[model samples]
Target chain A: MVFARARRPRALYLAYYFPPSRASGVYRARATANYLARRDWDVTVFACPMDFLDKVIGSKDEELLGTLDPRIRIERPPLNQYVWQRDARDFGPLRRTFPHTAQKGYAWTQRRLFPEHYASWSFASVRRALALHMRRRFDVVVATGNPFSSFAAAWLFRRITGVPYVLDYRDSWTLNQFTDELARPEGDPVHTWERRVTGGAAEVVFVNEAMRAWHAERHPHAADRMTVVPNAWDADLLDLPPLDLSVPAAPRPIRFTFLGTVTAVQPVEEMLSAFRMVRRHADFSDAELHIHGHLGFFKGADAALRGRLQSDADDGRDSGVRLCGPVPKTEVADVYRESDVLVFLTGGARYVTSGKIFEYMATGRPIVSVHGPGIAAEEVLDGYPLWFNANSLDPSALADTMISAAKAARDLSPEEHLSARRHADTYERDVVLAPFETRLRTLARRSS
Target chain B: MTLVDEAAKDTPGTEGTPPHVVILSYADPVPQRVLAYALYLLRRGVPVDLVTPTAPSSPTSATFPHFRVWEMKSVEERHPVKWLQYTVVHRLPSGVLNRVRRVARRVPGGGPVLRAERLARRTHRRVADLVDRRLFWPVYDHVRPLVLARASRRALASIDFDAVDRVVFTDTPAEHLAWKLAQRHPETVVDGRLDREPYAHLEQIR
Candidate 1:
C-alpha cells in the first residue's frame, strides 16, 4: 500500500524589528512569528543586523528565543542605513576623520531620506531572500512594518514572485497620529507608492479597528481586505507565580511604573505636571514615579529631550519621582510586581495602541491612563477592572485619577484582583495570535 | 562656457559695487546650479537676488541674502479635456502623417498651407494652456520676466556692465528661459551653457 507524504505549510515572515532587540514592537513580531511556527508552518524571518544595536533596549530572555521551533529559519541582512555607538568595528575611516560629525550626519541622512533609506537596503535584502525563495517556494508572505520599508520590500518580492502578501501595519502610515498631518500628500511620490503597493496586497492587518478604518477610507477599493490583530500579553510572562498581595506593616513608597522608551512624542510634560499635582494635593509625600526606560535613541539631537526628562526626574525626587532606567524583558514581571500602579503615558491622540498596554493589563494592577481619550488603549482598558481613565491631559483630572488608583491599590481585595487577572487571561499572546495562525493556514491551503 | 567661466572668476577684495543678479526659480535656496553661479559671483563681489517659486520645501530666506525667491501669476490659454481624452484613447496612424507630409512637399499648391498647418497644429494655443494649467507653467512665465527685470535694475544701478560681465544660465530649464529672455532683452544675456544642470537634469524645461 502506497502512503501519501504529509505537506508542510510555507510562510515568509518579514519583520524589520525582531527578537534579541527589545524594542517594544519586537514582542508582537516575536510572538506572531513563534505562534505561526508552532502551528506547523515553516517560517522564514527576514530582519536586520542593525536591530540589536546600542544599549537602547537590552535583550534578556534567551529562553523565548529557544522556544522558537527549530524548524523555523532566521535570516539577517546587513543594514547600512543606521549608525550606532556599538557598531565601532564598522566605523573605519568614518571614526577617524569626523567622529562626532559621522553619527550626526548619519542621523540627518536617515531623516532626510525617511522611507528611502530602508527601501535602498530592501533592494539587497529582497534580492537575497528571493534567490532563496526560488529554490524553496514560500506559500505566503507576511510583512510587518514600523519602518514601513519592510512592507515595500514584501510588496516588491510579491510582485516578482507572484506570492500573496499580507501587510501588517503595526502603526498607521500616511496619517500622522500625533499632529493629524497627512504623512504624504495625494500626489506625493511616497503616497502614490503606498497606494500602488497596498492596492495589490492580498490582505492588510492593523493593530486596531480605527487604524483599519482609516486605511480603508483611503484605499476604498481594498477595504474588503483589511483585518485587525491587536497587540497582546505573552502567556509565559503572565504565568509567573501570583504576587503576595498582603500589605506590609508599614507601606513603603507608592511606586508607579512606566516600562517603554521615553521619546519626544511621549506626553512627558503632562506626566510630570500630573505627578507634581499629585504631590501638591495628595498627602503621600513618599510616592515615587519610577520610569523604567531609556530617553531616546537618536544621539546628540535627542540630548535636549533626554536632559529635560532627567531634570523632571531630578525635580520630582524632592517630591519622590525616580527614573529607574530600563529593565530587561526577563525582569519586566518583577518591575510590575513591585509597582503599586502602572502609569500609561503614550503619544498620539487616537488610533495609537501601544504594546505595553496589554502587558500592563496582564499585571492585574491599577492603571492610570494619561493619554488621549479616543486612543485604542481606552477601548481595551474600558472593561478592565481597577483601571483609572483620565479623559484629557488636564493635570488636575489626572492627579485625581492617580489618587483614586493609589487608593484602589491600597484597598484591593483578593477576589477583585483575581477578576482582573481573569480579564487579562482572554488577551494572552497565544490566544490573540491563534486567529492569525488560522488565517495564515487558510491562505496557505488556498495557495497550495 | 570659457567666456562665462572667465567672467565669473573672482578678483581681490577692492571695495567695488557688486553686480546684483535675481533668479527666477523656486523660493528656497536658489537651485544648486544657480547657487553655484551666485557663489562664484559672490567671490568676485557680485550680489544676486535668486527669485524662485514661492512654494519651496525649505525656503533659504535667512541663509543667503542673494537667494530672493518669490511666486507670481500670468494669463494663458486653457484646453478642453476632450482633446486630452482623444489623444490617450486613440492611436495615431504613424505612416499617414509621414506620407501626407511627403505628398504635400511634392504637390503643386499644397506646400505652404501644409507647412503652415503643421506649424499651427504643433503650436496649439489651447494645448499649451492645458499643459500650463496641468503642470503650472504660468508660474514660470510670470516669475521669469520679474526676476530678469529685478536683476537688470540691480546690475545697472550698482556696477558697470564690464564688472557685471556675465550672467551664466545654469542648464536646460534655466538656459531655455535665458534664451527666451535674451531674445526679448539682449542687454542682460551673458554666456549660455547647459553644463551646470542640478538634480542630474531630471527637470525638463520646454
Candidate 2:
C-alpha cells in the first residue's frame, strides 16, 4: 500500500475573545479559527476562561462549536484578571467587594512583577506549547488582539520557542485610530513594551489599509512585513437555504434592522433622528427601525448613551423607531430574513471596518450607511449595486438619505437583490483567509 | 563633607541622637528615596516620617513602624477653579495678542485698559505659579504634622529635599522655589541632589 503523507500544518491561534463568548470581536476570531481548521491546519486556540462568564457578551453557538475540526485543540489558561464564580477560590476578600477594581489591582501587581500581566501566562503556555512543538512543530503562531496582551504573549513565545508569529491587530496600539492621539505616551512603560514586542514579530496584519500604512510609517524598517487583511463574511454561516421573498407571512411596515451593540461611539442619536425625519418627510411613514442588540456590556454597567437611546426611543413613539433589545446570535439570521433594509451605524475614526458590515453584505439587503465620508466601510460597500450611501452626519442630509434609501429598498427587484448578493461572494471568510494561510506556510518553510 | 556631617556641623546635637528627616514627595508613585530611607532607618531603629502628596489612586496610611509615609493631594487637584485659570492663561498663544488688542479697543477703558491688560499679562506667569503653590501647599501642609509627630523625638532632624524636588519645574522656577524653601525652613531643609550620595548607602543598610 502506498503511504499517504499528511498535508496539515500545525498553528497556534491566540484570541482572547474566542467563542462561545459573544464579545463583538468573537465573530472575527471564531471565523479565523474555523477557517484555518477547515483548511487542514491543526489549529490550537488559546483564550481566557473568563470571557464566558463576564457576560460582556453571552455565549450561543453550541452548534458552531460542534462544527470545528476534531483535531483542533482549544487551551484556556485561567485568566488572573477575571474571576468566574466557578473560580471563587482564586479571589480574596477585596475581590468580592469590587471585582473589577480588584482585578485591576491584581493586574497592576502582576505587571510590576513581569513586564506584562499576560507574560506570566505566556511563560507557562509557551513552555507547554514548545514541548508539543518539539514533537511536531507548529507552522505558525497567529495572535489577534484587543487586550494587546495576546500580542505580548505571542512575542514571548516566538523568542522562546523559535516559532514565527503573525501579529493580527484587530485594532491598532500606540497609534489611536480615532483622535490620532498616541494611545500610550512615548517613554511610557506600555509604549516601550509594545515597541520592543512588535519589533521582533515576524509579520503584522491589520484590518484596513490605513492601519497598515500607519504602522508602516511608524516602523519603516518593518514596512515590508506589514499586510492588510480585511474582515469578510463566513460562507458556512451563510449556507442557509435560499430565502424566498414572495412568502406571504413576512413582517409588514418594512422593518429596518440594526444588529450590534448600541454605544456612544456610534451616532445613535443621528440614527434615531434620521429615522424620525424619514417618517415625517417620506412615503414609508410606517417603516420601523428595529434595533436588536445589547446597549453596552462591561461589569454589567449601563452606558450613559444607552439611557439617551431609551429617551430617544420614547421621543420616537409617534414615529416608528423601536429599540427591540438584544437577540441571541443563533437567531440573527431570522432577524436578517425579516428585515426590508439594513442600517449600518458605526463610530471611531475613518479606518474602522466593523464586523457587522460583512454580515450585512451577506444578507443581500439594501444597506443605508450613516457615517463620515472616507470610512473603510464605504470602500467595502462601494460596488454593491443596491447600496445607499449617506456619507454625512448632518441631520437633514441623513434624513434625506434615509428617505431615499427606503424608496430604493421598496423598489428593489428579485434580480437586483441577487446581483447584490453575488457581489459579496468574493468576501466569504474562507476565501479571505486563504492568502493568510499561504503566508504562514511560506514563513514556516523559510524559518525551518 | 557628607550630608550627615554637614548637618551635624550646622546644628550641634548629641552623638547618641538619631537624625530627624522631613521629606516632601508627590503622591503619584511612592517616593523611592523615602522608601529606601525608611527601610534603612527601620533597620537601624531610627524614626522617619515621609511627607508626600496624597495618593491620587489609593488609600495611604502609616504602614511601616519608625517610618510613616504621609500622602497629600496636589494643589492643582484641590483647587479646580484656580487650576482652570492657570491652564487657560499659561497655554494662550502670543499670536492671539492682536485679537485681544482689537477686543480691548471696544471696552470702556481703551489704551489704559490695554496697559493694565499688559501689566496683568506681564505678572500672569508669577501669579499663576503663586496660586498653584498656595493651593498645592495644603497637600504639602497636611503632611507637616505627620513629619513633626514622628521625627520630633529624634535629636537631629535632617530633611531630604529629593522627596518633593522637581528638576524642570515650569510652574515655579526650581532655583527660586529651592532658595525660598531653604530660607523659610532653615532648620529642617537640605539640598536634594547634594544629599543624595550619602543616602545611597541606605539601600544596603537593611
What DockQ class does candidate 1 belong to? incorrect
Worst 10-residue lDDT window, candidate 1 chain B:
B72-81
Task: For candidate 1, give the DockQ.
Answer: 0.01
Q: What digit string (tens of lDDT, one per residue) describes model 2 on residues A244-305?
A: 65655444687788988777678888888888777776477788888887666543333365
Superposed Cα deviation of residue A16, candidate 1 (Å): 0.8
Q: What lDDT does candidate 2 reach at residue A371?
A: 72
> Candidate 1: where are CA atoms >4 Å away?
A50-67, A82-115, A246-250, A299-302, A312-317, B1-206
What value of lDDT does candidate 1 attain over all alpha carbons? Answer: 0.66
Model 2, runs deviating above 4 Å: A1-7, A55-64, A82-90, A93-120, A240-251, A315-319, B1-206
State the lDDT of candidate 1 residue by residue for B1-206, as single tens digits. Answer: 00122212342222343444544442233466655655554444344554343334443445455444444211111122333433432223324445677788888899786887577555554565576567544444333333444434432344333433235543223433344444444555343331222212122221
Model 1, A1-448: lDDT tens per residue?
A: 9889767889888887775555567788888888887887889988756444443233333545665567778888766633332222223454323333444566675555444556655666688778888788888889888768777777888888888889999877788878767987777666766787788888899998888988899899889999999889987655555556675525687778788878788878888788877777545656788888765643333345655665655533374667676565667788888888899989887788888888888888899998878887776787889899888888888889998888888877777677788887788889888888888888878876
List DockQ, one per candidate, in order. 0.01, 0.01
